[model samples]
Target: MILERHGLGWAGLAIGLIAPFFIATPYALNLMTTAAIFVMLAVGLNIVVGYCGLLDLGYAAFFAVGAYTSGILSTELGLPLIATVPAVLVVTVLAGLVIGGPTLRLRSDYLAIVTLGFGEIIRIVATNLDITGGPSGIFGIPGLFGDALSGPVALYYMVVVTAAIAVVLAARLGRSRLGRAWRFIREDEDAAEASGVRTYRVKMAAYVAGAVWGGLAGVLFAAQLSAISPAGFTFLHSALVLMAVVLGGMGSTPGVVLGAVVISLLPEALRGLADGRYFVFGILLIVMMLIRPQGLWPYRSREHGTSTPQEAREPERARMEGTL
Candidate 1:
């Protein structure tokens, strides 16, 4: 378990270090950067969907909030993107708390509906509000690290660094005590509460954390686009982000990253596949689902102090276990 958990981090670091050398094409570099950003989104959502087993249908609302907050502040107020980080955090957390607090008491479809409505509310507000520039959206939002480091390549590096940090923080949190609480809630909320876990609070925490994560990804998105609008934060966007988490193998960091990369880049890569490519792609997705319903790399369970699966009692083996 230790090796399984740490191995992905080591591999990610190694890949990030070495990828720049092989990927010189600007298009390819952009794809990688976008993948990293989506990976951040997936990791954050994993906290809710993977660990906590919450069906968050509106994750992208937080992302839009972060993006819009940074875009508006940076353009209208003449602040740098860096200055907008705190606002992004505050808005996302409050949004999460407000949305999650009430709906979390409800289960399944009911909770999903409230979250979905919250998503639409965010998008519509951005569309109708003058401060959000209405449908025209904000433009010329500043880039990261100021003008001195605003080159496309330089911004790519910035993304690589920050995205890495986000990924690390999320994975660490997932392995912590709270993560266990989330899992317990996911599996059986009442049982977890009976066992002294505060199901309501933990669920709220998970929702807030996931919201913060989606919001951070939005900040990065704003930095990348240097613009914001209601058009950009749509229901499809939320579905895509959620799809990445699901297809990637919930609760598995590496699998989520792989899933994000594949989902984000597949369209670009499929440019050569012609008009019917989507047909093939859809077929492929179906095959993947049929084969790996749990995920491409499912989180495994084990007995203590052993690397193998716990099996049914084998009387003969137990008797010979006197070798202990």
Candidate 2:
């Protein structure tokens, strides 16, 4: 049964990989490209928030760092988007360490607040710094592979490849020993530490991993838009990604990806809503929260678990793994 499911999943992925070949309209292609970027961000956050049980309200900070890094470098230095990948990884890691080092020691509410503050700091610094071009942001950013590979079709594939890489890396990480440590920490931090798990380092690893992927997604964002600004990275943007992780079922990769796609495409889908859409959206969110607080696609029950009365009432274990 497992192999059958895997085969079907991979087959579906193959078809989705070729989806852009059939999508000829620039508008449709652009929408899909944006969705891919959203998926990348959600997946990256999954590492920290979903798997590790950390509450990061400022994940957009890493995302902004990545996009700005590539945007500034490519536009000001005559560098290619591909050339900015390493820097994005490095800068984001440093940013994660600088931020995570100070706050990972705190429990939930504190961590969340600190991360939220970190996010605002990144944006405020960008707004005040000339290197980030202030409010105008860095425009005319270059794409990967230059103009020869700058067509919509090329970009679609480029983003698809990058998102695919992130998904694979995240999945692989989740299956490793470190991943298990993260899970342990999430389930019970004190117990994890008692069991000889270095909770601090494990949490830091999750944070850094998330930062790296988030940063890479930023590079793709810069290449796709070829322009960026403070407006692009906002509190609402961070909240939306968090909503995707939650609504899609925190910790499940497939669920989170689906959440990312829906969250990204929702505004376009609601174009007919016009001025009333946001109002309706709030209503729907309230309804959904009441009806399915676990999210749109929730984690599956474990196959071999004992259903102790208390355990039965407990929340389901995350089948996939992502940050909420």
Candidate 3:
């Protein structure tokens, strides 16, 4: 089964590599590229919400921080966008720690509320800060790849490679020991704690990891658009990312990718529906929730132990009777 899954992943990567050859227009390429970036965001959020089971509504704050970090470094310091990646990574991780350290202690709705407030706070601060260009945000940002490979087609390929790596990394992380810890916490925090897992630390790690991914996506966003505003990192952006993870299948990498692609492309595909497009979209989402709540590609757990409660209990009972 694992081998089959690996083969499927490689095949998907192969198709993505050749996708541009079939696309005819720059607009189409742009849309595809955007979808790829969005996929990264969804994958990142999946670490926190899907794998770790922490609800984060302020994910876009990390995205904005990355974009702004790269934007500032590139425009003001005369650094290349590629050169700013290290700083972006550092800043994002710190941002995650700053927010997650205090807020992860809260459970359920309270955590969500705090995250939501943090997201708005980041946007508002960006809007008022001069370094972020106030309300206008940053512009004249350099490309990730220089003149050697700066065309739309080239950038589209670049984004495709980055997104593929991000997804693969998320999937790999989900299978690691740390990933198992995240699953434990997600399933039951109290049980996870009793099992010797440092629940707070594990949750923080997931949040930081998600922040890194979101920030990297932001770097791509800045490079793609060469400009960003507070408007780009709003609550709606965070909600959409959450929706992608939920709609796809939380903790399922391929499902999250499919969900992100659908969410990104569906609106464009439904543009011809005129004024009824959104209505149709809503209905489709509702239908999907009703019929396939687990998601289009739900995660399939590999571990299957045969020990049943009765079977295990029989041995204990026999041992007790013998002792008596």
TM-score against truth, every candidate: 0.89, 0.90, 0.92
- Cα lDDT tens digits, model 1, 24-102, are 7887777777887888888888889887888988888998889988888888788878888999999999999888888
Of candidates 2 and 1, the better by TM-score: 2
**lDDT (Cα, tens digit) per residue for candidate 3, span 1-324:** 121266776787788789889989889899999999999999999999998889999999999999999999999987778899999999999999999999999999999999999999999999999999999999898889545577888888889899998998898898777887787677667766765678899999999999999999999999899899999999999999999999988888888988999999998899999999989988988899789888877776645321222232333233323332
Q: 1 or 3, which is superior by lDDT? A: 3
Model 3 ranges with Cα > 4 A deviation: 1-4, 305-324
CA lDDT, every model vs. true structure: 0.77, 0.80, 0.86
Candidate 2 accuracy as lDDT? 0.80
Candidate number with greatest TM-score: 3
Q: Model 1 off-target regions past 4 Å?
A: 1-5, 302-324
**Each candidate's clash count:** 0, 8, 0
Rate residue 216 of model 2 by lDDT: 89
- Better TM-score candidate (2, 3): 3
Question: How high is the lDDT of residue 61 in model 2?
Answer: 93
- Cα error, residue 208 of model 1, in Å, equals 0.7
Ranking of predictions according to TM-score: 3, 2, 1
